[model samples]
Target: MAIEEKRAWIMAVVTIVAYGTYLALVLNAAAGAPLGEAPYVYAMLWTIGGAIVAAILLNILAAIVSPRDGGKKDQRDKEINRLGEHIGQSFVILGAVLALLFAITGLAAFWIANVIYLAFVLSSILGSIAKIVAYRRGFQSW
Candidate 1:
């Protein structure tokens, strides 16, 4: 697989794992209380930070394992990356709009934060999936 494809896989896996970990931590802390009452800021921050570190480390490892393939990108790779980013960016806009509405309605910070976080997670996963699909199924740039 190309390094970019491997990167997509790494991103998807790391994002999913980190988000799952965050949810589990928050839910467990909530116990029987409201989700908003749970201490989530620290958990969310830690998980996001961990995911970034993990993705970077994994990408480094991949490059170490395949030095020749590292840092190699052609027209197809660039185009597919652009396409995947465009596809993923939709979630970001949706999240921002939802957060704005929630804030305007005076919703709990928890809800707004979670919405944004989920949107980012979904964006990463979907973008990674799109990139992987393009690589595996052949991409055609218009």
Candidate 2:
């Protein structure tokens, strides 16, 4: 497989695992399970940490395996990352709008806000995964 393909697989796997953990935590919380602090707070921390660790470990492993594939992202890789960030920003905008509308209409509860934030978080994870997939599938900077 190409270097980009390997990177994409790694990113996709990590994102899937992280998202699955988030879903599991949310479901457990809804079932009255204690999060040891607060539901949203601990969940947020867990999700963020998982993403960070996943990226670090996977990147390190890939670098070790393919020393020729330096971690320096090329132009194509950079563009893929930019596209991912664009998608993430779009999600952020959606989340913000939902938050604003909820506040203005007095319809958004704390839990609702939390869910909306998580929605953005999930979207970001998926966006990264999508970008990686594109890179692997040879959809270069376009």
What lDDT score belongs to each candidate, Candidate 1 first? 0.95, 0.68
Give the TM-score comparing model 1 with the true structure, all chains together: 0.98
State TM-scores per candidate.
Answer: 0.98, 0.69
Off by over 4 Å in 2: 1-8, 32-38, 107-109, 140-142
lDDT of model 2 at residue 18? 73
Candidate 1 weakest ten by summed lDDT: 67-76
Candidate 1 segments whose C-alpha is farther than 4 A from its true place? none
Leading candidate by TM-score: 1
Candidate 2: minimum summed lDDT over ten consecutive residues — where? 32-41
Error of 1 at 135 (Å): 0.5
The sequence of per-residue lDDT tens digits that candidate 1 reaches over residues 1-142 is 9999999999999999999999999999999998889999999999999999999999999999998896799988899999999999999999999999999999999999999999999999999999999999998886
Cα RMSD, each candidate? 0.7, 3.9
Clash statistics: count for each candidate: 0, 0
What C-alpha lDDT, on a 0 to 100 scale, does residue 44 get in candidate 1? 97
